[model samples]
Target chain A: MAKELTPQEMLRIDLTPPNKDWMDIPTVIKPGIYCYPAKPEKVEIVGMPNPHVWSPLDDDWGLPEDWKETFLEGMRERLNKHRSFKIFMDICVRCGACADKCHFFLGSGDPKNMPVARAELIRSVYRGEFTKAGKILGRLAGGRKITEDVLKEIWYYMFQCTECRRCSLFCPYGIDTAEVTIIGRELINLFGLNINWIQEPVANCYETGNHLGLLPHTFKQNIEFMCMDIEDFVGVTIEPPFNKKGAEILFVTPSGDVFADPGIYTLMGYLLLFEHIGLDYTWSTYASEGGNFGFFTSLDMAQRLNAKIYAEAKRLGVKWILGGECGHMWRVVHQYMNTFNGPPEFLEEPVNPLTGTKFENAKSAKMIHISEFTADLIKHGKLKLNPKRNDHLKVTYHDSCNPSRGMGMFEEPRYIINNVCNNFYEMPENTIREQTFCCGSGAGLNAGENMELRLRGGLPRANAVKYVHERFGVNMLSCVCAIDRAVLPASMEYWVPDVNVCGVSELVGNALIMEGEHDRPTDLRGEEIPGFAKAEGEEEVTEDV
Target chain B: MGRNLHKGLREILVHKKGPIVEKWRELIHKSYPPETAQFLKREKDRFSNPIGSSIEDSIWPLFDQLIGEADPSTTKKLLDNLVRVRAVQDFTPASAVQIIFALKQIVRKEVLPAAQKKGLLREYLEFESEIDRFGLLAFDVFMECRERVWEIKRNDLLKRPYLLAGGMCPSYMMKRGIKHLEKLKKEITQH
Candidate 1:
């Protein structure tokens, strides 16, 4: 609501003859549109280089006198080291195929948020400093020398991007804008500028073996507390082995599953599911978190934190790893982990111990998603499930950004949901599966200060859910990511007030007819289990696995 | 006041509500790029254009409230539905509520000739005063919505410190649960 350009006074941008000098018009790096900077102490705790303190709103970012040279030097180093970075910088035709694909652009209607324009922010810097054609032609060749304002503009939009890679999917040349953002962020971090959301978690994960910085004792307490809930609800006890050496598999998941609500329910789902299947999996407090927040900050930081997972797996003598539902974690596990800190030679391929269904998709990474594991379980009829128990929820699935586009595991989640829930509806074809819209709050942009930005980015996704909510009475939204569980509830509150956001596991927990479990009358949150409350009042319902 | 002024004004404003809404939509969407504006300006199909369709949906009900009943509760209800949405947009309070002024423009364009020809300037002035009153009411809704947005932002700021310290996205668990239950209760009874 702070005043700036009124609607009538703002410049109207049009698709015109190729503009030779894009920098002639300064990008409007608006006030509320940017993120707060990282606290230097947190950056230092993670042992990152140049951990100098700065805030985005300050007049000066406390850069060293040689900050520009440092950025340029880092750019040169990356150009030499990563051929993909050099080629991505060199080869953009700007056909604008990716312009409308970005949720940030579609939601905010900001020209700079467009994928093409966002890439141009750093691409311009690349041309001016690195290319001969740019050095001679300067602004004529889409190049601009870096300035204080230009640095701020670059940092501002880099954080704005969730790096969901939906844009990369649409690029005809497949010029990944995410690659530009990754290296662009790495170069910018040479001077220690990072959003607190990303840097703080990186620091926590480095020191405490988890993003939430839960001590080993406290982490165990959280799991035990959930165990109590499971005992009271199901009349069955679950004592998950933690840091137990010689366990067959290492069970790792995002710590948000332990700390946040509804997510806690899904954690309960894992405990219940593992207990039911009698899988010999062990939880490790050392590699307490599966999510890699460092992946958003810098590659070195990501590698530093991700080292804990494989290190813990080795120390525990586990054969393979099974990951819980998360988006970016899978992205790192599937795409970057092996390249960064893998070959994980000590670990074996993931095979479902109960049914021995080998996960071919994760044979190399030695990790399998819980949905794939559970879908195969249901396929082989290893565990009991009651589709009627979840009759109350006419549900729709939100494909999280990384798993859908980054790994392409579309039908695994849908297959599980269809088998568990009676009424399931897909969002519009364009907004589901591979072409799925973001939860609008991925990649550590799920901060509270940016609620307006989050809401704006969420409009397209919420609109899609609302379509199904109105048409099919879908009061529940199920997803596969802990970030979605943390952020989408707030997004739903603003956009579609009636739809409740939850992890797919919460629904699975509700519907699973576990061994030695009591008759179910309520859901994870103690909400009346809709139609079941009536059925239970009149008749005792019992099912078996 | 002319004998037929109110009826003719209603005919002009109400009968031609389609163009009035279209003109209002154009004014509302003038800020976005033309291509994006096309999406935001779609008057039908809530799925394709939820925000635009919601804005368009308020048009007739608001007109009925403004001219026919002029009840404060009814006016507040219609405008609050739209104001809550516009509050979150990247615009100042003045600019956000500026959409309501489109009503005055629509009245001036659609009924000015009829009112002048009927020599009902007194009745027309009365109608203009009513719009001014509703405009003031809209200003109130806009201020309240802006305050609510800031309130949410302030609460977020308080909770964000914890997220920084421990990588938590904080919210009032009790409040969220109650909100979920309230909506659930409403849904159950409604069905």
Candidate 2:
């Protein structure tokens, strides 16, 4: 039997901070000096020499030696072809500051998963072989001759990074690891090294306009089902508009949230709020996926994935777009998509339909967050909520990285929680707002193959929640990201067994007040919804629209 | 090892009988303006380079060579040309630390010395300070790129290893991953 490797034993080799003036820089010193507390001091791994355990994904990954030539040719073409890519390449410095900031690295004890190191899996080669460093030092300066193995190593590692720009925040060079990952994936894709799971969804998103490949009819069917769930959960028959042309807003959300988990409940919250406030919104099956998996692999894929929303939005002819709660979806939308693609032809300037306020940054203005919109509605007394409905449990909110860090959406979700829930507790100051930790399973690392790492990385976050749970008896954890919903539960099970994770909308659903007795869907059919329907016409408001 | 080789070459260059003073005169003429350059030439000997009586005196001429400025383009051009010379070119103390200290005057004050120890003086030169944190050069560089840095320090949960794990940071994870590959090999052989 193979020996189990403990975290302390693995982390025995510590790079003692070389005494220096540069070490005084808050960003550099904070991590190196304080890396002892916030960052993992040790990583534990068992079942090592699994020579028998071969990754079928790698075998089918279709990466070959010729991939090096193909990738280099592609990189050269990109560098020569586009000014932005060249400038981006020249401007990038592979400082590892962003590496420790990544959720994937935090979750998985795998060092190859660090943003800078993962980037170096490609950038080092770029530095050594492509730059002046290669010409002079050759191999002595850590420059190596690029080979097929180098390309494969780049492919394997770069793909593992979720390209979450959490690292970009700390990167002294402002080198977006996600952007590097995008380039790496693009080079790998040139040689056809895409994983089957991600590629299939990307293809589905291309073909059916949703990652789940839901047909237009099925898409409508899901909306109808959600309306029924809302009637059961929120006591309102919310008919969220479907492909309504010339509508004021087009609501684009990740298909994952629309299909599964806490995101579905959050989806219901958007529908109920839209109905209560009488906002003109539509959902186009064509632009169904706000989350771009293609952004994970290639910029062309990112451009293509993003192009779908505008194409469909134009087809539907909405005035402006509203984004749902998902991490990378908003990251691509706010940071790259609006810049890479041209301004929308069909969407007009988004005036907050309720407040009459105009969002200036068209990227975020045109792309409004659902939480922000809902919070505003509640603030303005548009939607009436029964706070006691959420009395069954105490809840705390986990700020998703994209919405909070990517778009500065810290207040919107908190506002909704404060108004909608009777009892709500906030997490630690450092762990909230822009400094909030990732759910540890974002950036497409939520794959089944990465479960071990996912749980490990989630430890920090789970421990944080455990603090709240233990102190305040907070039973539920609420966050707005779908990936968080998918990954956080696993962490809760492993690290904080008692705490339950839910979407903010789930608590809202529990707390919504029924206007009419028929709002109870479960009583109506015993097939759906939840409770007993009261006498007919007791209230004029109808649950079924 | 590389530094020692460079030092050995400097010693050999200094010991040679060839016009060392003339070389100094040429450097001063190239580095300074016509007025300053001429003054430096007149002060030094025309034939033999004057050996400094002590280490402090010897470094004085090197300092004059470094900071006594002439035309910017011409000075940079001379430095670039000097950097290309075979012995003093790549192996020069100029490449090793001089230009970096000069740059430190502009962007940062004291980064060049520590940067030299890591063999990262060249790489660090490519970066300009953004945030201006004293020791946190990385954050400063990041801020220049318009990036923000956030720290998650553990205040209470010191007992739980999860809260304080290093892999929580992706950079640490990558470093750990590379470091662990060695451990994996060692552990594998141990069994």
Candidate 3:
């Protein structure tokens, strides 16, 4: 600078890391990466503890006077209560098998985003406070006392994880890193440190029985709007029942499908499929939402929100429940719901009334995913099908993380896709099925402000889709999760502009030939089928004659 | 404008392409943490290690484009492919585009001695200026990619207005926050 250095010298960049331990490297809270902190009113509405206004960027988080005690006691209680938590904390052999398995690590290239380092953020504290050796030998044993910076680092990286369990799939010891993140989040919520994107949905689900905070009438009207679209597009009029007693099945879907585009098309598919099959199902605005955003907050909140479904089912006297296409909702239903809210003796085991197929796997939870139900219908040849209507689309399936890893219902959605669409291709093997990448916006991280994080975390999944789009010409990314329908479209638009995202049932709606229906010339979204324009032109010419 | 100068520059660049690209790739890998850099350098698969594979795939073509006529469209396509990935990662605009400038340092170190021996130092300086221009172009591409990210984010918010605080739903307007609901309702209906 003294001699006015040349631009070449000024442009020099040294990217080497400072020679400091990772523990000493303070976490820098950046905007556009982390979600906004939860509003105190939302926390208060849900009866969570320590409601306060705090910022992630602030030096002081305005923790309660007894925050350390509260946090440590919360950790202690969780460790004692959950044997998996205690075992995960106690397990050793820090093998690096799971280091490269995380999409966030792959996309962002942040070592802390690696599942091992992420778990260590909490595991270090667990060792420091709980284990005797860590207490005696401090940093030598890879343990550190909890500090404000440590707490901040924990909150930062824990939310960075989508809890997709992809890392856990690769853990040689089968250590569930998602469970660590879940417990980490639970402790963070003990001090009211949740992000608004998650807390608002949890509060909304608690208050109005849905994450979108949709009122019952507004919810019904939204669906009626879809029904009207079905009438105008598909030439069908079917009045869907709501809150009616003695219905054989009570259908629950994520409110995202009712509110968001492309997801609404999936909802319309459910309606038409049910109408065609003439199944006795009722929609309950009380138990309207199938998604449990509270699962992102804490186990108790998850169970609290999930209680509505079983309560509504018992009240409506429904025999069993049919869940719509969703990601985390299935994780809750399959893994935790029965343990949290079950032994549902009042409700009978879920059996496909149309196909006479008993869902023995869902015997306890008594809730069958829509894909399983629809696949059984196609298997029994119970629905009129025309795969030619979807000729315009070269489809590839993305297995939503929860259903593939948590529920192992891989073949059902694939079976349905093969039956409904003529042209189908699979993405790369490692990126599908049990090892499927996240949509990067799951676990309540799909907020507007955190778009950069979402995009970075979405790279691995989008990279695979880009491969298929380039090699096999895949135009439609069909998935079974409503969050995938809501979020994957944005990722697709950003990474692979040639591909579009939709739900599996939307393809079904496009291909289903309803009885006594008028001549259908368009897909479910009212886009004209590729070969239908000539037929419509012929019709117009005949009419003129 | 002299044909000999262009030929001499091309010869030096092609002769030294291996060391230059290897050093440039090392600098790019250094942008990440030590452990992550090790993993990115070790993994060779494109799908499993997309960021590393992308950097490897783009740098060689980019080097070739730099040595050749430097077609703006082809350069932009290659730059966009690389910068697009970096724009979304944890990178400042300067840090993101700095990788492009690191190539100049590599060329100067690797090609300068050969050019000096051949009395083409002035031509090599011109080539360095070309790298400066490419670096500036990289900055433009980074900004464009970032703007596209913001546009995608804006579209997401407009598409899902319910995610907005105090949105259209009555229940969303908790604790006397109903003033914006009508406006939000209009926005939703318009959408």
Query: Candidates' interface RMSDs, in order?
Result: 6.2, 23.5, 4.2
lDDT of each: 0.78, 0.55, 0.87
Candidate 3, residues A168-281: lDDT per residue as tens digits?
998888999999999999999999999999999899889999888888888887788778778877889989999999999999999988877778889989999999999999
Output the number of the TM-score-best candidate: 3
Q: Write down the lDDT that model 1 would get.
A: 0.78
Q: Quick one: ranking by lDDT, best first?
A: 3, 1, 2
lDDT of 1 by residue, B53-129 (tens): 55676766877775564566867877876776666665656666767765677778877777788787677877777
DockQ of 3: 0.38
Best by DockQ: 3
- Residue-level lDDT of model 2, residues B1-191, one tens digit each, is 01222333233333431343334334323232232233334433211111111112323343233223323344333332222111111111222223223333432333445446657555444433211211132222223221110111110111123212423422222224435545655665699
Tell me which residue pairs clash in candidate 1: none
lDDT of 1 by residue, A377-484 (tens): 988988688888789888999999888899989988998899889999999888888788888888888877777778778877997987899788899899999999
List ranges where model 1 is wrong by over 4 Å. Answer: A1-32, A531-545, B1-5, B14-18, B33-85, B126-191
In model 1, how large is the Cα lDDT of residue A506? 81
Best by lDDT: 3
Q: How many residue pairs clash in each candidate?
A: 0, 29, 0
